[model samples]
Target chain A: MNYNWNWGILFEEPYFDWLVSGVEWTLFVSAVAWIIAFSLGSIVGVARTVDSVPIRAVATAYVELFRNIPLIVQMFLWFYVVPEMVPDDWGRWMKRDMPFPEATSAIFCLGTYTASRVAEQVRAGIESIPVGQRAAGLAMGLTTVQVYRYLLVPVGYRIIVPPLTSEFLTIFKNSSLALTIGVAELLYQARQIENYTFQGFEAFTSVTLIYLVLTMIVVALMVSVEEKTKIPGYGIQKDK
Target chain B: MIMLGDFDFGVIVTALPYLWDGMQLSLLLTGLAAVGSIFLGTLLALMRLSSIRLFQWIGAIWVNFFRSLPLLLVIFWFYFLVPLIVQGQVDAFESALIGFVLFEAAYFCEIMRSGIQSISRGQAWSGYALGLKYSQTMRYVVLPQAFRNMLPILLTQTIILFQDTSLVFVVGLADFMTSAVTVAQRDSRLVELYVFAALVYFVMCYFASLSVKILQKKMHK
Candidate 1:
């Protein structure tokens, strides 16, 4: 009840700059990580459903390993433990010379972790295509690789757009965890402002709104994609 | 200077007690929050399903508001805001617990809502035909079936809650992950401790997920 509320402090010179930089880092992490997730997830998801047993097992292992561990733990493992586990020169580079080591580790961590979830969605999207679709593709004299390239990948990606949008949004949220390892992302900057100004409420409130807005923007963009790429009477349309 | 050859899981052996204590707290938080959220979630789900417009709005807002923000932010908000509101210091652990329960209740609400909806309307109508009140039908007939239907998903969500308990590290809670880091720091054995923690989590969550997969398969049949 005795709290001093200062809404203006958030827009103050250094704090405002901090907020912008924080958002820049957050977007950077999420965007880069998403590239990794989308690519790796596609490969892994396809691998899981492939006819090759060993390939399927390897993809399943990849998903299980990454998905089972907590993101923070994975982040810590990547940032702290991984350097030591590698050779000495690589560890030195990671610790000292690599560009934005904290952020880079975070990108990889979030990327691989989300990739597992994305892989699941991708597998679901692909699997939902009906056995007949795969059979028909094969029956049409298409090779397995050709079938995926020409038919499955394009259609499967479209089918899973909604889930992928949420996954992309999640990477942004997960990027906040990078702060634990000293990445100056949005959440980290919010805490920095709170530390300097003691305006914890305002700092957090602003950051929360920023995250919500970011999420809304992603939803809007993806919804457009969904609308543009509407497959006539195929793929499940989940209620928003 | 450390190499893969230098990996000494002996650190885990030495730090087992601390890690065990931390694991206990982690499990305790996950268990408590899971149970609390399910109860709150059930209420919210019912409210959303209720014919009353105000209850439906309240339920919808609660779920959407929490879902829209990151859990970490919510935890930070509770940790910082509650002290100011009460004009007193709030325990970090308690704040984190409150944050987890409230935030997780939102997710559980959606799950429960879907679970309830999945139950055929005819079943509810049958209960109504048997001279039962709306509340009675939900209590005796609808909820039990919903719980049965969603047990695997509930367990899967609980596993996620267990993983999430590690996030309390930001607020200085000595949960399992934090404990491993603590020991790793004090002993200067970061590699061993982190890998051990990852393995522990991997073992528990992997098997749990596998079982959930099996349950899903069985249910499908």
Candidate 2:
């Protein structure tokens, strides 16, 4: 290899700032989208599991539509098409009022798309609980909502934690697609740095390392959580 | 002041040649990558499941590194880095294809590993009891069952890879999306052009998914 590998570019002040800002945006997007996806997923997941036919139908439709569409396409649709379709005042409000406008749109798009997958996981989690638990709640004179609130949701969340963590990591990786719409996240920053210095290898390699670190951190955290929640002697409660 | 209706669809009509050219590139990339990934992935899966500690570590690291990074970054690394190091002009499409194969192999390995693990340990033991070597057992018994179980998932991953082929456009390869973008830029019809391109992608992916479902049903029987 005749070419010198300049590790110093990563240490340079401006590049360091770009790297940190990129990591921050990456975390911010992942955290915000995870929260959004979790909330939306729980709601839709509950809906899907509920006995009400209409609720199930709506939830199923939502999951099918979002899951089938590509995340990039969804991001574009949210950033471009939805705004165009909205009435002028509302559209302007959305464009102007959203925090970190471009990043927010990406988060919203990624979050909702991921929520569909999370929703399915949650539904499976909820359904996996023995029917006897719900029956016992009903026998104890609790309403359906009360049974879910007091029993099912908590147990389901605990059981589904592992899969939910996998979903979060996925949403985190998918956030990189936001670069297409000009979000100055890690991948986007790398692209900017590359454009400026024409150091594509250096820029991409650094970002790849950062992503690897982030994902490893997520996996470690999830594993610890899984260990913490493991019920002794009840070998790995399987949630489909 | 370009009105949507006033714009000629003839641009799209005329760009059919370019679109066909791009489609051929897309298909070639997808096919080559799919085949490469499946081969590499199967080997990685076996390595991961091997009794040897060193092989397991190597396989684990390979899967971890590839799966964690975004596909675009991988493509960029190969496109820019490999040439600088190797002192050869690798074509943009080849770099993109190699990148996709490498990245996707990790995912396919994981899927295959899971499928293999799902099978009972007795399957392998029985082969041993029948005097088969490990390699022979894997080839004749374990892999046959594991591959069947993995067929649907592999097909699903293929659909994913097909969509991911669009990412190659970022590296300046004129795949379908890139061609659309080029034509659209010339005519300043970003929205329409992107919309049409997305429809093409959606149609391709939709059919891929549908066929997978059909195959899954047929395989199940």
Q: lDDT (0-100) at residue A106 of candidate 1?
A: 96
- Chain B global fold similarity (TM-score) for predicted model 2 against the true chain B: 0.93
Candidate 1 at A177: error in angstroms? 0.4
Runs of candidate 1 exceeding 4 Å displacement: A237-240, B1-4, B218-221
* Candidate 2 docking class: acceptable
Which pairs clash inside model 1? none
Residue lDDT tens for model 2, B1-221: 22457546787888889988987888888889989998899899999999999999999999988877877778778887888877989888777888888999999898888888878999999999999999999999998899899999998988788878877766779987678778877887666666667677777777778888899999879
TM-score of chain A for the candidates in order shown: 0.97, 0.93
lDDT of 2 by residue, A30-83 (tens): 899888999999999999988999989999888867766566667767776566
Residue range A110-178, candidate 1, lDDT tens digits = 999999999999999888887888899999999999999998888988888888888887888888899
Of candidate 2 chain B, the 10-residue stretch with the lowest lDDT total is B1-10
TM-score each candidate. 0.97, 0.89
Residues B1-221, candidate 1: write the lDDT tens digits. 57567778677898899899999999999999999999999999999999999999999989878887888888889888898888888888788889999999998998899899999999999999999999999999999999999999899999999998899988888999989989989998888888889999999999988999899899889
